[model samples]
Target: MRATFMFRAGDVRVQNTPDPVLRYPTDAIVRVVRACICGSDLHPYHSLPETPGGTTMGHEFIGVVEEVGADVATVKKGDFVIAPFAVSDGTCEYCREGLHTSCEHGGFWNDTELGTGGGQAEAVRVPLADGTLVKVPGAVDESLYSGLLSLSDVYGTGWHAAVRAGVTAGDSVAVIGDGAVGLLAVLSAKQLGAEQIVLMGRHRVRTDLGREFGATEVVAERGEEGIARVRELTGGRGVRRVLEAVGHLPAYEQAVGIVRPGGVISRVGVPQYRDAEIGWPFFGKNTTLTGGPAPVRAYIEQLMPAVLDGTVQPGRVFDREIGLDDVPDGYRAMDERTALKVMVKP
Candidate 1:
């Protein structure tokens, strides 16, 4: 099998790797059908000093099961499933309480430990298969590829951010990034009944998709200018809910600063902080802050129906498509802000 690997910061390559095999009774091996490059992957791709060299890259994928362990009853050979980025045992205390991401047996598919290679490979080993894999309802189609692939990360994550922010009917919400996750946050907010959505992005293509996904306003400014514009749009009160999708310090600060005094700031960005700071102004504002690695498993079932029925098309965020060999180019394009999201066909 050929898998994508990040040998060092700013380096991504597709090279031959050994095929994945079932390592646990709850595991299943799947042939990768569709996979994607995520924005979070950029953190290490750009500046993580300790990012291990020669590690398989990628974490989002949709695929068909080629084999399953004896204990994996929910999925079997030939079933098309959505592999959530996190593998969790459904029976864990945390999983039972809806915190699947924190399950005692939960883990991520990475280069270390029980590595199943990367989603950007020809096949992947999915642990806790019964709990982490969701079968696509009915038939799969070309139009459904992106949506199915989204179930692995972005769509579920964006929905989690919206839910954590407490977006409600008639409330105004602001999304802090224009990537696939941010655009889907706009869609999720809309589905949650928000009356107004303000997308903070400068790209016309992304902003345009934001509107189509239910964003009522698009603010192209950044830093103080962006915050001022958001305040101006909200009658100086700022929005009630702020969704932080970019993990950088500036974006984090912007999310905290743009919300009203009693607003909620729900962040889904994988913070790349060595020594993160939250000043006095944040505490003085009395705003509620919440967010972390999204427990995507908890929301997959809730969001799947919408995707299957055409009520929401989170897949619209995919702006470009490339083959597995072009993944390095995809990363470069996204890093340069030349693409919103890249869907890779293996």
Candidate 2:
């Protein structure tokens, strides 16, 4: 089967690769129904050395199981399922504690030796199938694809950020970033009962979606001006919770700066730097910081119902759609900010 691979930085192409098959007793071979590009993939696309040839890119997808190994009982052939970005064994200690992303037996699909294949491909090998795959209820439909696919990563991740930020009814929440994850953070805050949801972004399309997702205010400013605007909106005390959806230094600082003393800052963006400076401003604010890669498997079950019931339409984040052959263009469009999120159908 043909798969998308990163030959080097700035070089992503669709190339012929070995077809994926069941590799473990708990594995499942999935014919990908839908896949999409992710922001994290852009890191390697722009970084050197890390841009090794043959690296498959992508982590979000929903698919139909073509085959399942002997021990996989929860799912079977022909079932539509959402494959979380991180593959994990359900019985692991970490998974039992609701931290599937850190499961002892968990592995990131793109980084494993098997290279199970990315969502941007025609098919993918899903390991620990019974543990990592969530069966979509009832029949699948066009409208369900985007939302179901999001359960694999962004939606759950955004919800995790909101939860970590301690969002609650009547609390003012500021979401820093307008990407799919950030926009979802706005939705998550509203779902959690936040009275005021402020989205900080520059794009009109993304800001529009943020409002639909529940953002009551939109601040297109950045740096000191952005901080001033957030403060101004919160009556100068700052919001009670801030969601940092962009992992860069500026976004991090903005998140911290816009929250009131004793507030919380939940960061969900993939950090680009090894060491981000945290000075007196961060410490003196008495704010609590929490976040890391989301444990999507842990939240999928809890979030699936909302998607099914149409209470949350996370798929709205996908503004562009393409086929497997057009994945390179999908990456370019997202890299250039022409699309909020791109959905690739195989």
Candidate 3:
């Protein structure tokens, strides 16, 4: 098998790896059909410490089941499935409550301890196959592959931000960042019935797509100016919900600035900072802070219908495509802001 590995910052390579096999009763072997380089992958691409053995890269993928262990039942050979970024046992307490990310037996892909290799490969060993892989019913055209792939992470992640923020019909909302997740957050807000969706991003191409995704307003400014502009748009009261899609501290600060009193700020972006202010600004306004790793496995079923029916096209976020061997160049393109998202077909 050929898989992606990162040896250090700015280093991604495709190398031959041992073929995956069912290692546990709950495991499954999947032949990768499609995978993607997530925006979150860039964090490691920027500054991961050197690891001689290299860290496996990627988490989002959709593939076909080639083999399943003795205990696996929910899916079988030849079933097309989507693997969420996190692996979990579907029978766990947290998983039963739709919090699969907190499942007792769950872990993320590429975690060395779990040994579930990265999704950016020709095949992967899927831990907790019954829980982690959502079987796509019947045949699906390749046209919808990107949309189904989005369910594995970005779309689900953006949906989590809006859901945690409590977006509802007629509510006003603001989204921070213009990345794939941010644009999808706009889509999620719209689907949840938000009346005013303000997208804060500087990229013309992204914000334009955000508008198409239902952002009623686009605020390209940053810092105080950006905050003031969002506030002004909302009649100086700010928005009722602010979805902070960029994990940077500045994006957090912007969320604090544009949220109305008693509103919520949901952060889905992986935080890059160690600490942030939660004192007067949040406390005084009675603001609520929420959002964490999205249990996308819990959301795949709910979101898949729309994608299958063509009601929503979240896959538009994938503006570029690359083969398995070009993943290194894909990283560079994403890092250089040359591509919105890169779809990998192995």
Candidate 4:
């Protein structure tokens, strides 16, 4: 089998690797059918130091179950399944509370130390099989693969951001960043009945898709200028909910500036900085700061129906596709801002 690995910054390669096998009673081997590179993957691609064997890449994927351990009951051989980015014991207390990302015995994909392989490959060793994989009901059309794949990460993540921000009917919300997650946040906000959705991004192509997703306005500026534009759009009062989809410091600062008094700011983007502002500015406004890794496993079932029925098209974020061998090129396209999101067929 072949899988993607990052030898160092700007060096991603699809290399030959041994096939994965079930190592635990709760594990399953999934032959990846669809996978993609995530924006978060770019973090390591930008600054990871050289490694002897390189590190595995990718997290989001939907595949056909080729094998399952004796203890696995929810899914069996030949079942098409969705694997969340994180591995969790479904029976844990946190999972019962819809916070699978915080499960007592949970971890992420590509944890080589834990013997887990990357999704951008021919197959992956999915630990906590019954708890981590969701079977797609019945036969699925090939056209829906990308949409179903989005639920594994980006779509669920966007839903998490909106849910954490407490988006409600007739409320106004501002979403920062125009990445896949940010655009999906716009879609989620619309579904939650947000009356106004402001998408802040610099790219015209992505922002246009954001508009189609539900952004009532687009603010392409940054810093103070962007903050003022959002304020002006909301009648100089800022929005009640600010969904920060970009993990950078500037994006967070903009969220602080655009959140109205007594509002909430949900950050779903993986944080890239160490420290952030949490002083008088947020304190004086009584703003609530929330959001994290987005326990996407919890939302998969809730969001899958819409994708299956074609009610929503969150997969529109995927602007390009490549074969398993072209993963290196996929990473470069995403890193260079030439692709909104890249889908992989292994």
1-346 per-residue lDDT for model 3 (tens digits): 8999999999899999999999999999999999999999999999899989899999999999999999999999999999999999988899999999998988999877688899999999999899899999989799999999999999999999999999999999999999999999999999999999999999999999999999999999999999999999999999999999989999999999999999999999999998898989889999999999999988999999999999999999999999999999999999999999999999
The full ranking of all candidates by lDDT, starting with the best, is 3, 4, 2, 1
Against the true structure, what is each candidate's TM-score?
0.96, 0.97, 0.99, 0.99
Q: After superposition, how far is residue 153 of candidate 3 from its true place, in Å?
A: 0.3
Candidate maximizing lDDT: 3
State each model's CA lDDT, in order.
0.88, 0.89, 0.95, 0.94
TM-score of 4: 0.99
lDDT string, candidate 1, 1-346, tens digits: 8889887888888998878888989889999999999998898798745445577888899989999998989988998899888888888899998788888977888826555677888999888898888888677887888987888899988988999999999999999999889999999999999998999998899889999999999999999999999999999988899999988888888887789888899999887665544566777778888988888888888888888888888888888999999999999999998988999998
Error of 3 at 139 (Å): 0.6
Query: Per-residue lDDT of 148-241 in model 4, one digit per residue for the tens?
Result: 9999999999999999999999999999999999999999999999999999999999999999999999999999999999999989999999
Point out the worst 10-residue segment of candidate 1 by lDDT: 272-281
**After superposition on all CA atoms, what RMSD does each candidate show versus the true structure?**
1.5, 1.3, 0.6, 0.7
Candidate with the larger lDDT of 1 and 4: 4
Report how far residue 219 has shifted in candidate 3, in Å. Answer: 0.3
The better candidate by lDDT, 1 or 2, is 2
Q: Compared to the true structure, candidate 3 yields what TM-score?
A: 0.99
Clashing pairs in 3: none
> What is the TM-score of candidate 2?
0.97
| lDDT by residue (tens digit), candidate 2, 1-346 | 8789888777889988888988889899999999999877777777735455667888899999999999999999999999999988889899998888888877898866545778788899998898899998789988899999988899999999998888988999999999999999999999999999999999999999999999999999999999999999989999889999988888987887888998998999988767664677878888888989999899998999989999889999998899898999988998999988999988
